[model samples]
Target: MSAEKWTPDHLQSAENRSLHLEQRRMQLLPVVDDLRRLAREMAAVVKEIDGIEGDIPGQAWMRARHVTKPLFKAADDIEQAIGDLGAFNTRYQRSYEELPQKRAEKRRRKALAKSGQPEAIESAPAGSGSPKKDEFEDVFDGLRQGA
Candidate 1:
């Protein structure tokens, strides 16, 4: 079911999922921060290596540039994963604390039903005549008699 229509059990499950995602986000933060630092370091190293020799495309320059691509991409991917986990946590965190109360209310009703208690009828059963029949019954009779 959609998150908006979640049952209490589903809410608890969603809350657990968010908690797990939050944990994953926490674990990934340090790694991603490290990767960002490393990417910055790679940029500095690339600039340094590029300037070492004048206008000569050496093996060091080529290797450095090639390695930088994957490192930067890895950093980008980690950043994206962190963002996703954060969004998931934000979406489901409230549900974690709200479900138990809802579930209890649901259980109370279920228990009441299992006890065979008669539920109050808000409206009369179908095909049953109106309860105020006598109040209206003389109106038409009076009109006809006056005519």
Candidate 2:
């Protein structure tokens, strides 16, 4: 039923990989937090610029206005980095979560095969014992049945 064969060693390896990925994902949180802090600082800078504009004369502000655009651009860059990190973290978490499930499924299928039961039959309910079928046949039947 599973895509790959499983052994104890295979399951252990998958578990280890999952743990490693989870650890790496956890490590990313601090970096993301730091990026958030940086973004907040940038926002403060923008607010300061706003305050400066309100207090200073137009011509004088205009003379020093070049700094504001660059500050805003830096903020945008930090925000983009945070977005990218979030995306990476999501993907990492998904892969980590799926790895253990995949390994368990593989083990179940292998055990079924070893016990002389069809992997497909093992995957289905106990009462569904309509002879053993190959994966393709099972899939085709499901499609035909609109399941």
Best by lDDT: 1
- Across residues 78-105, which tens digit of lDDT does each residue of candidate 1 receive? 8798787667556565555567767776
lDDT string for model 2 (29-98, tens) is 5665675576567555655654443455564445345545565456466556656655654665467667
- Off by more than 4 A, model 2: 1-69, 119-147
Model 1 collision count: 0
Best by TM-score: 1
Task: Give the worst 10-residue stretch by lDDT in candidate 1.
Answer: 120-129
Cα misplacement distance, residue 78 of candidate 1 (Å): 1.4
How many residue pairs clash in each candidate at the backbone level?
0, 0
